[model samples]
Target: MSNTPRTLFDKVWDAHVVRQIEDGPSILFIDRHFIHEVTSPVAFLGLQQRGIGVMFPDRTFATADHNTPTINQHLPVQDPFSANQLKALETNSSKYGISHWGLGNPKNGIVHVVGPENGITLPGMTIVCGDSHTSTHGAFGAIAFGIGTSEVEMVLASQCIMQPKAKKMRIAVDGKIGKGVTPKDVILYIIAKISASGATGYFVEYAGSVFENMSMEGRMTVCNMSIEMGARGGMIAPDETTFNYINGREKAPKGADWDKALAYWKTLKTDEGASFDVELKYDAADIEPMITYGTNPGMGMGISNKIPVAEALGGGQASFEKSLQYMGFQKEDSLIGKKVDYVFIGSCTNGRIEDFRAFASIVKGRKKADNVTAWIVPGSHIVEQQIKEEGILDILTEAGFQLRQPGCSACLAMNDDKIPAGKYAVSTSNRNFEGRQGPGSRTLLASPLVAAAAAVTGVVTDPRDLM
Candidate 1:
């Protein structure tokens, strides 16, 4: 080992380098590779065409989510393309001896959600998936990021990826967060301050009291959106909280293995004198429940704040005005009291058990507004079970909301749960880009509490008011 102090990212990345080519990308060994219906099908086809098999089928896991219908999962898929992808995923996983979790399986769910709950994600591991939110696994102190289809195939064949290392960035938040603020709100506040491309070509490590005190689920929510700010991925140093969340979970180390794993995990932290390429800090008190008014995640502000005029925002004034026009809003317009046509509370980002509890807290005694269409989908079968076990389903039912099966629904327009054209939706999912939810659909990305508030009130409202 070198005498120089190293960051958490350095410790993990250095350990995984298989070969460093002169003046080119290093070949880094991958610890875990997760694939889904949409991204894995093509990679598998490429594998067959090349007459090569997976190098480590045990390290790769497959699940059906991106293209599966959130409702009527038991029935045959209506879309021919989606059905073919799902079938291909099952067939390929079986042929290659990889673990497969298809719809109707108790373990089936979104690829990201199922990975952590089942203990497939662990500290100090290098994980990758075809989906951008693969960064979610980094909450465990792992080096995780999204890869392209060709790279996915490369990993399946060789268990290695060629990549130039990303620059390291550290974002720290201190002070106490106010009521109604959530992990989602904190990240939105960060992205808005830095702009969407601020962290381009960097890997972020979250530090300070705020992230240290956040729950594993909350930490996952924050890391999951790191890509929205142009980060390669985001991670937090593992601690007792991370250990506790993994203990006793299926596929996690146990007995002598548990002790050995825990000892190694304790070392997955930044050294005292380590430095990053860039560093930034924020006060938690400055963040509140946030919502995106324009087409991007960075185009956001506190729920109670008015949209800033174009000149004050600085940058592309024409693009800013165009974003507002796309959303049917004007400069200086307030987000509060804006009518919402739909509310969705599930995705790899905020579709955890804690998110549902937050939603239920706001809708406990209230009923859904007659004009607001609500889609309360869980992230996985495990999360769905948790909702029913914790009585969150009952609260949603009493509020005139129906729970949908687990899947990556409405976060994108890939499945049947798309937002209608010209409709306004308060969503807990990450991203609010133009037509992200559906063609011509207007999206306001907010926390689960904000979505619940809109579900009941039929308009944008501050979640703190209800709390």
Candidate 2:
């Protein structure tokens, strides 16, 4: 309706529009561009071919994450391909004069984690990276999304990318969440309810009491998984929670600038009468600690529930059968008591300090299952430091679990922390696609609490049961 006010997405998108073409995409200015080793090499090569320097080097930040080894990062990278990619990133950042946080640097960590922790991600900004998880920055009310190598080049050359605006959707989860449930569980439940492609062509805004009660770290975990459900991105409107989280961060504004920024951020919410192209609502009490049974994130269920029979799946039965076949599962089989070979509790999705604390809470006095190989990684050096200061590392060690260095370890098989072939892992990462954790490795995505339950019992045990 013409009388309806603009939503958060409209305000941010309209503010960043550099130019609107008559019949084509708008040229949108990017406020922050994050580059990681894995995706920036080709884009930098393109820049070299064009002989064009980066338009705004100050707007871009580079880091080595996907290809960085979690262990012995002080030593030289062992894999030749990985070593070259890291080297390329260093070279490109140096030549382009962009700020880079390489291995051994105090700020070095996953780009998504490091950006927000260091205040590089601010409210009302347009952020992009070559990685899909860039949507994580949207927790601060920013318009952040993933871009391809070509789009990377476009941003580097002109600080702008041509893009069509996404339709708006609002997903509201209300009521009090039950015990043992985490933000990871909330997002997983949503994806399972709507299917993987449910939010396609839309930018989603999360609202209601559930998100309002969540900490900044918890909110990041939910927004980080937006890409898994086929949404362009997801965000939460800025409020006191957002302001408090950003106030004293390293890159956040200071003094008068802080006051000015806060005033503007307060106005970034959807108006009372704002209309959305689509809307979804859920009751928080209905969600439980969740886990995936098949190869996709949407193929998930509450930990206490049985997998749906083929007739219950909306997709083609053949495809559903193939997913089950790959996961070594039969229709309607319960996941409880199923043996697990590994348990990984880190990733952009659930690698924050809160995630570590949750895992430590579960494994404090219990020893890990002898058959389970548990990899507990922090998202950043700051988180790693916090774990030590909070004594979480000591509790983990006493429980027979090792705390690995900061990096995107085991989330993907890119680094040294890969699950062996044919092994099943209970992972807290976003994706569980075929071979996502390693060649022939089967991934059952779950919350950190669920992963902790698997680590201690060596099976797909319900977290609530352990509680």
Candidate 3:
């Protein structure tokens, strides 16, 4: 091995390069390729059109998510397009000899959630999916990112992808985060500090005490939203927390294989003297439970803060005004006490057990506000089962909230779960882009605690106050 120091991103990416084309993109071998109903059909159809089979079917995993209804999943799908896509995914996966978890399968859930829970996602791997949140897997110290339909077809055909390497950035946060703050808050704060496009053209490595001490689920939450800030992806160096989370999972290595894997994983960290193209740091004490006041994730501020005036914005004035108008708000407005029509507590970003626990903590004793329509969703069936086992379901039921089955419910408008037009929702999902949850539906991205607080109070209340 070379004696030069390397960052974790460099180490993992360098190990995966199949060939570095001179002055062009590198061809990198992919360790995991996750596909869903929305983006895989065209890629598979392309393969059929070309009369080619999947190069390494074992490396690709398929699950019906984007189009599957969260409720009554066992019943036939109602939408023709969604049904067709679901059918196509199953048929294609079967024909390609790829492992598939379709609706009603006990193992089924969002592609990102199922991968890590089943040990299919590992440290130092190169992972890709057609969805942007594929960065969620980067929580394992892997080099993971989203790909387009064409790139998906390419990977399916060769188990390799061609891509230019992204610049490296290290974002380190030191000190203990305040109470009621979460990994979601930390990421939102980071995105607000650096605008939505701040980390564009870079793959980030989160370091320092904050990420190191975060749970694997928390790390996944942080990494899941990396793309929202315009990053190629974001990773956290694997450590004992990662190992323990992966150990004994359904497909994790066992016995001697576990020993070997653990040994390798332990080495998946940045060397002391490694350098990054850009570096930034934050103090954890400054972060608070956060919420997005405008359309984009970067429009976030502390829960207690007011929306900035147009003059204060300095740039993007027109876009900022448009975002606020879309959300039915004005500059200098305080989001606190604003009426919320809906609340969502699940997605690949914050649908883990811990997020549910946080939501439950805030709602355990409080009843749901009569004006709020709340959707409690789990990331996967496994997480749904976890909610039931941990009594979260009971707490939710008592609080007048219903637990929807998994499969990316309310994160997007693809499935039956959608926020009505002209309504405001406080969501735990990653993005708050206009109509992201549904057409003309204003979304306020926040942590589960914040969502829960809003759910119970029917307003954008501070989770800290509830806590």
**Per-prediction TM-score:** 0.99, 0.99, 0.99
Q: lDDT of each prediction vs. the true structure?
A: 0.95, 0.92, 0.93
Residue 423, model 3: Cα distance from true site in angstroms? 0.5
lDDT of 3 by residue, 150-177 (tens): 9999999999999999999999999999
In angstroms, the error of model 1 at 256 is: 0.8
Error of 1 at 172 (Å): 0.3
Task: For candidate 1, list the clashing residue pairs, or say none.
Answer: none
Ten-residue region with minimum lDDT total, candidate 1: 309-318
lDDT winner between 2 and 3, please give it: 3
Show the lowest summed lDDT stretch of 10 residues, model 2: 1-10
For 237-343, candidate 2 gives per-residue lDDT tens digits of 98888888888999899999999998899999988888899999999989988999998899999988999986777687988899999889998899999999999
TM-score of decoy 3: 0.99
- In model 3, how many backbone clashes occur? 0
lDDT of 2 at 346: 86
